[model samples]
Target chain A: GDTSSAPASDAATSSVPPGHAGDHNSVKYYKGIVPAKDLKVWREEGTGNGKLAHYKPATKVDYYKIGTTPTPAQIAGWTIAVPPSGENLPAGSGTAAKGEAIYSTNCAMCHGGFGEGKNNYPQLVGGIGSLGTPSPEKTVGSYWPYATTVWDYINRAMPFYAPHTLKPDEVYSLTAYILNMNGITKSSWVADAKSVPLVKMPNRNSFNWKDPRPVTHNSACMKNCVSPSSIKITSNAATMNLTPRLTGPVDHMKNGK
Target chain B: GATMIAASARAASPAPTAPPADNSWSNSLGAPVDARPYGQPSKYESSVVRRYIPWLSPTRLADASFTPLQDQPGIITSNGLFFERYHSGVPTVDPKEFRLMVSGRVKKPLLLTLDQIMRYPSVSRIHFIECPANGATEWPAAQLNSLQLTHGMIGCAEWTGVLLKTILDEAGIHPDSRWVLPTGSDGAHMDRSLPMVKCLDDCILAWGQNGEALRPEQGYPLRLVVPGWQGNVNVKWLRQLQVGREPWITREETSEYSELLGDGKSLGFTWVMDAKSVITFPCPEKPLTQGPGFYEIRGLAWSGRGKVKYVDVSLDGGVNFQRAKLDNPILDKCMTRFTLPYWWDGKPALIQSRVTDDTGYVQPTIVQKHKFWGHDPVYENNSIQTWQILASGEVNNVQLS
Candidate 1:
């Protein structure tokens, strides 16, 4: 039923096969997609193999004719991302000593005073050697490979509720404060565009770049796949009663009610 | 009555042409067509809607909702009932002042307005977008009882837009460009670094979904669609695309998304979601109403790698299995609906489904997943799902050791 991969030689298969929904034609719903009468004409175009009937591949055209060249002023306003190499890292400097006050006033409610995490929010510090243990605590100090990401994240989406409100100096101070709390840096260490990108974290080399996927090769074993004696019921969600009940479609006067 | 019948049957037999006693709908005039300028679903289908848990996130703005997969009949999810995931809620952008900027590592930096973007050659394709953390809650055990809660983070729809290749070609990419950083216009300014090959392959700057303008939650005026990748990388409320030489280790990619291995070293950039499937009909929410009779067991199977080649349904745990029939329009990287004819025998049974993608990769079991990646990695939980069917015809979520 893959129209794009269908052989061109199978031109005889021009009509919609039985048991096939009309929407399967890729046009979907002749009511508004295509007029009811034009449906027959669409199928006659030899595109009835399930590909989008209206699609046409791109062709040659004049370049730089439609959109205008973006001015430097406009580009400066929108460019906000800081890459790994810290190429576009912003200017300004701050120290953990200066950021201690900022952390309590802005970030400590959800992120915690010692950066150990509060409630359900993510913990920003510690968990350096917990990755190999059974209970891995993946935090900024333990997991993240680069420290510039700390500054970037703080600058872009910190304070949770009021993001993009922190100034560049405040972001640098917060990054330094988090680093100091994680024991990666001292409270007196200054952080800036030049200094933040150069700071080496413990987990700098703790990443696998190559992706060797299709890790599990499972066969469709049909009969006696596992010993019946080895089968065990690990958990049952019905007994927990954690699922929320709401009245809506498919109520059936049961648990959904 | 017999005398009246005899009087009516003058030439032959009398005709029974009277209307049914209770034709309530047709007994009165119907509502006018313009009653609802923009129509909504019938009130009877109120329960077939998207839902979210209150405790899923810290705030309501940064939350996720699950689509009622059990109620969705086919591969395509209706626009209104589609799953919703937001980082900073939805922002209403004025189309008159919107512009998509293309800069960094490009020969010509261009700023295209909505009208200019719509003028390009457009192609509409059907694809499935799935959150990598779909089954994260159930990793430790079966915590969610409903299919909507377990597998509701995914939705498939027909998307219409111009290919990123078209836009890149217009701007003329630099020879040294290898990675692209796409940033959003939301409060968090969600950004992700992607390889150039994926961008040039099937990425689309989409503005339309399922035949009309995209909903505000799904990114109204414009969004980015990286086919067959994690939903996070498909930046919504797209604002800019910056071509660069190296990957930008952003917060979303580093502090999150990456998989932490058992050995302490994590696997970064694990984007493609492997083959996964779930039995939607006989799940916790949708139980077998009729007792011990012929029924159709239906489910959904898909892969980020490619089309689903086969889906096998097991009615008795993992002891035995039967090949399920794959429905039509199994397009590449799209959701495939599968069904199996089943007859319940009034006995306790364990129902499950397994999928094999076009790349000959079978859906792994939870045990097998833990063997390689360990149980700590929270993302990418695409393992075989088991549902216990009781003798009373109730289905419950369960885990097998």
Candidate 2:
């Protein structure tokens, strides 16, 4: 299966082989949760004919204009986000003491330290009258109503195992030390994007943007509909069984109880 | 319960006169055509897997599971127990060094590959995806008690590829574009923003699945369905789309899936995915100890803003309810499967189902989504679930108060 369409017009960096130069190939390549590299192998190099030569184009192309445009500095190195009127934001400006030393060596294990979130990670700071309470604790300064979602989520997902490797002022000093531990600004405040959406979050007037859905317009009731003595009970996730087990087609990462 | 099997109307009454006298695989001679060359699924359906709740990912590059959806039935979703949710793990791409590209506000920026995106013109469809934190640990109450951990992230399949406005109509698009983003070469470069009229509507760019070739944890040769959005914008290993005009949001639309309300604003690209329903045989991993008598309750209803028109059920939780039937083709944002049949009488009831999709939305209770997503709905969490049963018959996963 080595069809050679012959168009070899010289140098492609020579010294080929190594299984067509794809590094070490152990079927690696998956980019998602990233870690596997190695598979390489797409060698076209210096015509030393070690096979793989199917370059027979020019028989009149344009299969929807074939491909190869990518430029603007390769789309500005993947244009990372940070909008919310601070447009693209990526410039710099940090404070709250450089986000407490970039939140202790890249976000303490997983969002801890001043952000107060570490098991199941997500605390970002006090719950400010816990949103209509029932155990609410949203954080990011009492539930993020936007501070450009804290410098676009710490420069697109902060060092949670290295995502976008934070920089724009270390994502504006961890969004000014997580909005100064959620007191919503201070600790000498100073993030960017127009004072990070002008702070003032505190449940930002309890969001609404539509979708209220038929929360309880109750209809389709083929019978009684809400009177069996007003059906009381209210909670119980299966007497604490905690589900988890599901294993059979092959243990999907065990651990249960 | 899940893995309950046999119920095409209860196998159309097939118990007439079964032979019970010395049946040895019905008297021997079986194993033939490539005996076990590659087919298996009947060793008692072996519990149907897809679990992995390792405290829902904190590392190893995020990944989460759960989708045995009560062992599954009618509405497809068996690409090895579907429901995945990876944020970094699962990449091995290599479709001859895949590519995709597309580029922002395009007037002409193509970069296709994966055999020019399987040579464009394809279509299939069936939809579903979900996981706007499918029940984000039931935001504030009755948490995970199976319906594959309360509404297994969700799956549904079929999906075939190419229709992102047929690759943005050969990359022409540029009338002040209006969001597109997509991204996703994995490694948390997940990306989001969608809106170019949902990639010119009906999204897709898929690469098969349910008809095969997509597995690599469901984004093999490429991925990006977006049908009904939020399954983290369906950007599996799909690589790039860009087409801007603003709206990158990212960080999974601003710190994961975004929804939070109860004031403190969050919503962001809400997308569709509203109307929802679920019964999944007697919850808590299929309980009810075989139901005091006749059965058939079944469940599963969906809606990313389409089909599912009706589905009620409620064995008394919402007071009485009834109209359940629904099954067959229902299509649209897929997954329909409903039933009813009744006759338990063993007492202590309280089930629930409630849907209402064709845009009318419905499907809400859990104290009206705890009074409008108070305690900020970590993610979608469709609501109305309930369960109960018990008079020794078992069941549980309750809430309705």
Candidate 3:
């Protein structure tokens, strides 16, 4: 099944899988993934060792005719994800001044008028160098590594109440306005694909990742793992008492009523 | 104990005029099988349902509800009770109208219907899907003081669907196709580009959860099941899988999810969720009562990379630990329930559970995890949670240094 690793060669050996040859003329593996008509043809006319001795060859491979090739137009419509590179940037541009109006009309309610963020909503401006501090202010300008992410997010999921409602140019304007709020961009700057990716957000390189991690590790210690006397309570939560414990009358008490 | 003096007759039953009356159909025939048609959890379980942190998001329309892990009985999370995190709202899609499009750098780009998808030979495997953000608030010791609040962002279910490779094979994956972008049909169009290696490995295009059709919140009709990956990568209501060469580095993977360290350097392709575990019992919700005599400290342990190797329980912080008995049938990538029965004599106690997966990566202490990822970005904080149980039988979520 791991056909990717082994390149098919012209000098076929007994060990080579039925369809793993590198060339197009090789016994390519369908693995039962063909269309209904194609599968029918394969069952009848295919000359490969599919029709084996005594065994139903079709039973070995599992394939389904579940999906179809989407039209180019459909992919264009659905694949709206904008990466950090700002590739596939739409044809539109807007200035920070234009973005200010769009931001107030659409995003101001939840994100705050000036992108200060209200309540738990994310603040879009300020906190330029706060990421390294004990208390970080992660905003569009301060912590976002890529400026295109802001534009992509607004185009996709912003306006909290109405997602994907903003037009491309509106999203650009809003991106510009938010970047300007963070001082990542000038008020006169226009945000298009080329300019948005260059906003150079602060704390852009603050995220750390290592896969297959125990980037920090702990072995299974059966006893005396650490000095019990050395254990210290760094934080106390009893005084805060933020957890909501809603208590009500019990309706069921195992009585036969 | 004070002796009970006989109270007034009215105090007994408010001037009991009628003693027997009737049974009031208490013994009547139970309601017919179709009396209520579909089934639901009993009304008494009203409080056992999911709860969301109201401060996390503005409305339930685009927010996550923590699984009631503390209240849950076993490893199989109920379909209705499964934890759901939705960036956009849950979309109402007709299976007949749904078409999964597979295109880009493939020989046979295909758009398959849901019926056609079911035609493929299906495989059922139980895997735990965890949001890396599990126990995020406790990373900096915020006040979300419950197991449901701390560790409820994960749930395991027996997911049934066709292997992602089965479909990719049908599409004739080109050698150039290094990454596959599976996009959600929700309004947000949430999409995550999974590396081709992971797609070909063990991912599934799942439509069934816990032996039934997926609940709407759980991405009904279809969703991608990237076992051991972040919950966001499992795009629900999957609409398309475009095979390509480069990772899209979408918003879900970039602007969010990626961990921001104290040093201001972020990691982008941190795909596989690390090993983690938590003690569900004696949590803030299940405070130790009655002197905690012979309490079986039970909890769930799991890792994205593989099976949970062993879980250890520490009675006095992390100073010492004892091997906890893991319940039978610890499947790979599924939650393993671990229990350690210990006798207690009503003393102040600090309890913690540590996990190690089959990969031999031991679950780190809170201090150890923070050492790697300092502060601010609060995703994947799967550190050992220490619960301080006071002599008064009240439990508090505490961090030990």
Instruction: Give the per-residue lDDT digits (tens) of candidate 2, residues B1-401.
Output: 54345555355555434654446776788889888887877878777777755666665458677787877977998888897888667878898888878776677776767886787578998888888788777767886666786688888999898888777767766544556777777666677766565566578888889877889987798888877767877888877787655453444654466676665455555666777899898766677686478878898898987899889887878877877889788988888999898788899887899988877767877676766656546777787888888877777787766
Interface RMSD of 1: 10.4
What does candidate 3's lDDT look like per residue over B1-401, in tens digits? 13343445435654357664345555577678887877887777777767776556656677777888888777889887788898877899888889888876577777789998898878999999998888887887645667887788988999999988888777766544566889888887888867676776689999999878877887889999999999989989888887665455567776678777777666666777888888888887788777758888899999888999999999999888898999978998889999999787799999999888888899888788778888545788888888888897888888888
**Could you tell me every candidate's TM-score relative to the true structure?**
0.86, 0.34, 0.82
Q: Which DockQ value does candidate 2 get?
A: 0.16
> For model 2, what is the C-alpha lDDT against the true structure?
0.67
DockQ of every candidate structure: 0.24, 0.16, 0.24
Report the C-alpha lDDT of model 1 over B219-275, residue by residue, as the tens digit: 778889888898889888888988765566788987778888788877777889899
Residues A1-257 of candidate 2: C-alpha lDDT, one tens digit per residue: 11111122211222331112110111121111111211011111111122213322222223455667777665656655444334445555888887888688878767777667787776677877765555667666665555665676666556756677766878888877777766667687677644554454554445443344445454565676667887787678766656555555544344654
Q: Candidate 1 chain B: minimum summed lDDT over ten consecutive residues — where?
A: B13-22
Residue B250, model 3: lDDT of 65
Is candidate 2 or 3 superior in DockQ? 3
Residue lDDT tens for model 3, A157-181: 8787778888999999988888787
| lDDT value, candidate 1, whole model | 0.78
Model 2: CAPRI class: incorrect
